[model samples]
Target chain A: MERKWNKSSLMGWQFVALPSALILLFSFYPMFQSLLLSFQSGKGTVYHYVGIDNYIRLFSDPMFKQAVFNTLLYLIVQVPIMLLLGLVIAHLLNNPKLRFKGFYRTAIFLPCVTSLVSYAVLFKSIFAVDGILNKMLLSMHVIQEPIAWLMDPIWARVVIIAAITWRWTGYNMIFYLSAMQNIDPSIYEAASIDGASKTRQFFSITVPMLKPIILFTAIISTNGTLQLFDEVVNITKGGPGNATMTISQYIYNLSFVYTPNFGYAATVSYAIVVMVAVLALFQLKLGGEKR
Target chain B: MKKLTTMVVHLFLIVASVISLFPFVWMLMGMTNSSSEILKGKFSFGSMLMENIHKLLDMTSLGAAFWNSAIIAIIGTVGTLLLSSMAGYGFEIYHSKSKSRLFGLLMLSMMMPFAAVMIPLFRMFSGMGLLNTPTAVILPTITTAFMIFFFLQNTKSFPRELLQAGRVDGLSEWRLFTRIYMPTMKPTYAAAAIITFMNYWNSFLWPLIALQTQDKKTLPLVVSSLASSYNPDYGIIMVAIVITTLPSVLIFFLLQKQFVQGMLGSVK
Candidate 1:
């Protein structure tokens, strides 16, 4: 990039300046404004900075606590299961002798193309008390009667978990499949020569090699789940008594659904920012990214 | 034993594939059935397709919703590609310490969840008197850090020799970027375009907040509203959801390779 005029350094700014300005205006400026709003109190127009009262209120807020609990429940219960299932499927499809790899890949990956709201609505209908699932179970004698799936609190949570897992497992599988392809086949050959079983090879070689990707997907899924507004908002509407209410939904409720409390909602939103930062750092350390 | 193991693997894949593909099939079947028939677990096609389309058209402005989504997705995707790529090229090609620090700051923006910025953004847009408009929905996401990251990662593989030769040919920096750089990076642009379009198309939360009016509502918003009704007609919902989901599906199938490449670019 060295030039006679010493112009390249200044020239690069011309390209980047507009986009940098836009990101600053939309992303950073609003982020700071949100942070400022979190510290203020009162609704709509009349508001003033009230120290950390909003932060203190967050501790005692039942709805906020419930939302956090439901979000963590999804992250703990759904993420590992989805990632493991994705890894297993990717491993299976990575087999050279496996037939119809393209078909399987496409079929599984097809779910990713679906919009979150669309799939959530579809899953809701499918799991309704008198819907296709209950009908199938009844015909097969697996259940003696139709279960009101979205009515029960526990089952409603399960339905949300299932819906998220169903939509995203295949999406994660694509990542693992590509990463697995990069692993040297000769490494597996050597491990087999040394009498490592298929299961052993997967655990030792494949899992270890895909650590960074696992960490990546885990963080992405965690962030996504924490902001889990769409599925819950659409599927259950945070119903069965806020059983599946995520923090994002709570933010929406605070600002829009309920009386306008953008101040407190911004406070709640900051909680997510802190949690995301903390969890991502924790995953990076746990995944042993030093190597 | 090994043969049995392989058979079991095959069976497992079959079940997984069926589960993955079943809803799509169910949605298609639902398109052809009435609401109550679908409720009673009828899984076969019926003669209600035309009726459902008729009802959907009568109930909502389906055409307007589709048009809104198309406008937002197309314009937003094109703007995102251009702006993000320019920033990416500047950061990578220049390779300065100050630029790297600035890039790091921009990357931090990626971690700022939309919820955090939603309230302020709403206020900002409303203050500008741009509520219920496509610009509000399109502006915030037009130059995302994630898309910029994608371009930067892809740019690392770009050949520097071309830039040297172009410079020798008296090509200005912007002209070189336009004439030489863009043509060589068509695949990257395509990949970025596919992913960006799908994102804008499928985006719900921001658009839901920004676009408040009915006629201005995008397809996802319309489908969501339709299903949120007290006594939703499953037939109408089926039609709406199918219409909402089809564009991304078609784009995905058409440029499946670039879509995958674009996604992979993020992590790499």
Candidate 2:
């Protein structure tokens, strides 16, 4: 039943139109302004149009390249592990015989709820040169001396990846768990009656069922990891010669920490937009078509 | 082997929980210890909790900062829910190809990292002479694409028959939304309010950029700046962290039932 468009109806449309227009204005205007600013170059308040120069400079800049590599590395390495672990744990939790489900769920989910400052401080202390981790490793005969988890380049990246995975796996698991609740238990029962192993049921039934939400979380996680800043900044300060610097952290440093290179920073920001758009497009193509 | 695997998963979950809770435990212990004892990594309670609390109160304008955070969060959350839910209701009920394309474009904005736009956003506010205003921080955030996306997703399951019935009863569109749709969507609104409040209360970046004066600083920014000092007092920082984290946790605890209830509607 279509409601006829009337005066009050038109007024409601007008009201909705105004807010949507304002939202589009704020969201698009700054983005376009940033695009314009990216073409111009200079120190604070003095600038000139330098079309393609900022892009060229970005291409040539070693730091930007390193940031790109680190962000991509984190994206490639961390996303799959977190998603798989989330799926596995979620499947296990979905088991009918699993006990203490609330305790397990809350325990795993607590990491993300911890304030960012505490997590940073905690990680820093635990990974310090003579920290508890090293002491444990030494006494356990796992290491000859100490592993400077944050000071070394490779180990620092590993630690950051581990940190992200630890904090987010449970969060992603919650999404899967919530999604799992919507599935009919009868389907799993049918699978078990057909003599499907739990592992077989997971791969064939659960994974296929969760494909869309999995893709949604995956894309969001990609964007999140690509823009990773807080943990890196707070934990290592993107330190040891920018070994762990992410695109977002680099953009932050360019904007605030170093000289205010707003133009190049905007260009770098567009790089993130481009990457996320590409990945999202691919995800939609692969996952969105599913019913 | 199955039993062994179950045991391993249990062990892993226990370890993760300990690691997760360790910082909170440490922060509490730090609050109860002298600064020297904290730096020495004292892991137990001491005689210094009251002293640390007194020092925190004396040194910083914690009361004012807390009030500022509350005010901003409340206003921001309320404004966001009203405008965003309105738009979500409008779009979902009135879906067209054009509006769908516009929604797609809106989701694009959500993916762009906030840091990339930080400078231009700061410049825009400064140019508008709005620096140091809570409005400067609250306005841009209130109409977030993420929240809009959330509302739109939730609104998809909204019963359109309610609107048809309202129209049949000769209700205006706005009246239909306010009377019928809004009441039915109470659970969604409650969940959105909690998430939005937590987000605003924990917001750090934009406030740090826009708010310049001492009185304007929010709790997280104040705690961060305090922690950045040359001889950072671990005891006081611990106190400040506790203060900063309490409101979000409290809000979560209060609204968690609604939150979990709404999650089923959300993930679809």
Candidate 3:
């Protein structure tokens, strides 16, 4: 039995060895290296240790401040609206009596599957000065002239928020819909028998039951928004005077587009990590994990 | 009142679906129109589809970009599924205290933002003389922690009785894994394939940094440069967009059932 146990344990290690080694090299090792890099200061490959200076520089750096503000703006405005829309849509579609269920679900889920570059191209054209959105507003007599959506600072942020919400709402909805399946249907039946309306039951039962999944989506969206890059890079390029620049974009610009101050870039990346970690912890605290 | 409420629900769903699908319809129309027509917000199909395709092919190396993306995505997806699934199975089935601790550490690795590690990873690759290579793009992502977690979650429902039975039948551990465990996990494999393929194909940032040469660029990089040109051509871009978007959509439509099931398994 001792020999058999040893054999199986050896097999277990063999199964795990390759993947664990890869992760250690690619993920864990690089992580430590970046942490070390964050303490050094230089452009490109040249560097010398400057402990905590990068962190200190972050406080007075106007561009970093603007990027953080813009990222926070998206997190505060977009995530809630998207989650709410997703939950409502999921609740409505969860109705067994709803018509064209598959069609509606598939259509709504389609956006998440689109390549980031494709959708960004589509959105840029749609919101261009002479684009369809302005044309539609003009046709409806809502505006006398075209709105330069991507050129104006405020509207540029609005377009970024709208784009993120459009792409991700259905993704969060899938989580809600799946979690809804686990709720005992007879509870809703019982609620209705006790003279509760649909709205009442949704608020009291469904919301409470789906709280954990909601928390999951919230944390995920928080992390996603903090690391916002693709849309801003593709759509606005943090243009119209850095109006829509995100921290992730700033990091990219630092390393690749500019003189490649890799240490400062690593510093900015750590800021994002800290922000996401704090927010995630807060969310878990509030949501009260069942586990 | 019941009739009114039902009407309201239908109206909401219809409006949302229209909004969701409008970009796709517009993209298809844009592909067929001239650049000026697209800029002018023309909604109908024009006679320029073939012309746009020809121009796109002429202007850029779309064929090469597509080939690079395909090779990277295929190799990355297959390698990720095989290795990560192995670790996941070993961790879950061969339960040990130390292994569980290691698994927890792996989960923490997933939470670290890729940007934080990008500079160091780039330095490491450059040190190894792997810069501007597709292997740099493929190697770091080949054994993603999230994929391992996904497989671990799905493996929870896998029956242990089958393993015991295979053992009794004189099957070796490796043989049982190859001949039985793998074949039985078809749905999970399909789901992982679709997700991994889409990820590798659509990946922009890491590839953008890793690959420096024009010939080495992927489709997204080419499309990005084209769009940023001082005199951007909407027609040609729409063609490129369609090409970039089609494969993932096709895979999604084909494997959607298993995809959703796999997602459901994860969140549960």
List chain A TM-scores, every candidate, in order: 0.97, 0.94, 0.96
Which residue pairs of candidate 3 clash?
none
For each candidate in the order shown, give its overall lDDT on alpha carbons: 0.92, 0.79, 0.89
Off by over 4 Å in 2: A1-12, A130-132, A135-141, A144-146, A286-291, B96-98, B164-171, B261-265
lDDT of candidate 2 over B1-268, digit per residue (tens)? 9889889878866776676566667777777887766655456799888888899889889888888888889999999998888878766777655666777777667876777677778898899999998898788888877777778888888888888889889997778889998899998899888777767887776787889898988887777776667676767877888887766666556766765444333665
Instruction: Give one digit per residue, the lDDT tens place, for model 3 in B194-261.
Output: 88888899999899899999899999988888888998999999999999999978877988887676
Ranking by lDDT: 1, 3, 2
Among all windows of 10 consecutive residues in model 3 chain B, the one with the lowest summed lDDT is: B258-267
Every candidate's fraction of true contacts kept comes to 0.78, 0.29, 0.64
lDDT for residue A244 in candidate 2, whole number 0-100: 93
Pick by DockQ: 1 or 2, better one: 1
* Candidate 3 C-alpha lDDT tens digits along A145-261: 999999999999999998888899888889999999899999999999999999999999999999989998998899989988889998999988999999999999999899889
Between candidates 1 and 3, name the one with more favorable lDDT. Answer: 1
Supply the DockQ value of model 2: 0.43
lDDT of 1 by residue, A128-154 (tens): 889999999999999998988899989
Q: Is candidate 2 or candidate 3 better by TM-score?
A: 3
Better of 1 and 2 by TM-score: 1
